[model samples]
Target: MEPIKISGILSIILGLIFIIFPVFSSGVVSIIIGISLFFFGITLILAGFTASNIIIGILAIIFGLLFTFNIDAVSFLLGFQFYIIGIILLLAGIIGLISDTQISKIASVLIIIMGIISFALGGFSIGNPLYAAILIGVCLIIQGIGMLLD
Candidate 1:
């Protein structure tokens, strides 16, 4: 079998485990999301030129750091941060629309979708990590499958 096919199978299996696991903790979830946001923010900071992109990157970095280093206060702040990020994303999307590049608009749309999801999920009181795990796992599985197809 090809390596990509093996990777896809592994990703699917891992995703299933994360979806089924009951013992995962919130801290783990926080870290997972935090790291992802941190890197994503960095990528945005480097990729875009608009003010909204910079603001969103800064906000993402702040939230990512908070979740990574201080979980105690994150529960209270998560919802607010997510809302703020969502707004920033919307702003960025609007700004991107004004630009001539279709790639910018496409990326902005994806960011907006992610922001909306984050905003909606910010208030969940239970199984936060499980939710993140499942979402990430699904993404990984999809990516792996794409690689295999490629």
Candidate 2:
């Protein structure tokens, strides 16, 4: 089979896993992110471009270690992730609203609503992780199908 087709199949399978085992999938993702961050921190420190970089690198390493070694920290960090994503979406919506196009205005309103929901969910520490996992799964499935079609 072609590489794209193989990847498409893999994406679909991963998406199914995400949907079936949302909690496990999220935990795995968190660990992977933590490991990546730990390595990234090491790289930054070794590069030693500037004092600020070193500071940021140290901070990253600390957080990375926490995320890697502590499940509680991972859960906390997941909530924090929602907050970060919410802020980014809110900012994007605001920027989109600044545009003069009609579509932009409509999309911005939706984005703003989603941002508010994400922010509230983060603050409440509710079922956002489960919902996020399911949402991601659906998206991945759609993307995989698209890739196969292409």
Candidate 3:
């Protein structure tokens, strides 16, 4: 098999593992995000004088503190971001549907489906981070399979 195919196969296999054991992945991801946020926040706070926007630096520090100290809040914040993205996608899909183009319609439907999935995942993430992780894992698995086929 070609290198690309081999890479795809490996991606699929890794995705499957993530899907099967999502809690571990979620935990690990959460830790990494928390640490990153914490450090970034510190950086912003320390370098506030250099930032073009003072508010941005302050907000970053606040959010960084929140993510570092409050794991549940971090989860909810991430979920909220996803929900916002879904809402944007949903709007785009609606626009595509209104355009009446055949290809656009198909793309719109797929986008709408993705939007709904993202909305649901956001809700699930707020309720249970493990479920959110599972959703992400499933998405990765699907993408890997698509790549393998291509």
Candidate 4:
């Protein structure tokens, strides 16, 4: 719409592309976060008027270091965190079932159904990606036995 807005959007898009394809910028996104942490950190640490805010700032710096220095580890940790959250949500759904209110019962039922369906679908896809491959192998083995007898 406006020139400034369009410029900002374009910049964001370019930045995202650069981040996604870090080869284009040689991981400059990571470098920037690390550098920002190293500097913003000092400012926060120096402004030690509040302990809680300082702790948050320190955590941010640590996260930045993790992002920059250990991108793969960060991604893995994020995935692990999501898995834990999913399990926690499932447990919460179970607890909601145990204690029936009004809307909670409906939410619990829906959550259970979704969990069942997701489990089934995930099993089907993950467990059978090579269905045709396995079938072909078995058929070939049968044919070989039959030919050997004949």
Q: What TM-score fits each model?
A: 0.63, 0.63, 0.49, 0.34
lDDT of 3 by residue, 1-150 (tens): 888788778777877777889877776555554565456445434543433224444554565555446557455565464464466457556655775433358887997897797688788887766777777678777877888889
Off by over 4 Å in 1: 22-26, 48-50, 77-88, 99-103, 117-150
The per-candidate count of clashes, in order, stands at: 0, 0, 0, 0
lDDT of 3: 0.63
By TM-score: ranked, best first: 1, 2, 3, 4
Q: Candidate 3: misplaced stretches above 4 Å?
A: 1-3, 32-54, 57-120
How big is the positional error of residue 82 in model 1, measured in Å on the Cα after superposition?
A: 6.2
**Best lDDT among the predictions, by candidate number:** 2
- Report each candidate's C-alpha RMSD, comma-separated, in the order given: 4.2, 8.2, 9.3, 18.6
Q: What does candidate 1's lDDT look like per residue over 1-150, in tens digits?
A: 888789878877766665666235345656665776687678667776667667777877878887677568567754354465566566656666676533466786886787677667554433343455566567666876777787
Pairs clashing within candidate 1: none
TM-score between model 4 and native: 0.34
Q: Give per-residue CA lDDT, model 4, range 1-150, as digits (tens).
A: 555555555555554554345343434434554565555455545644355435545754676576457567565442132232233335435645775333368786775665564344334324332332233334444544444444
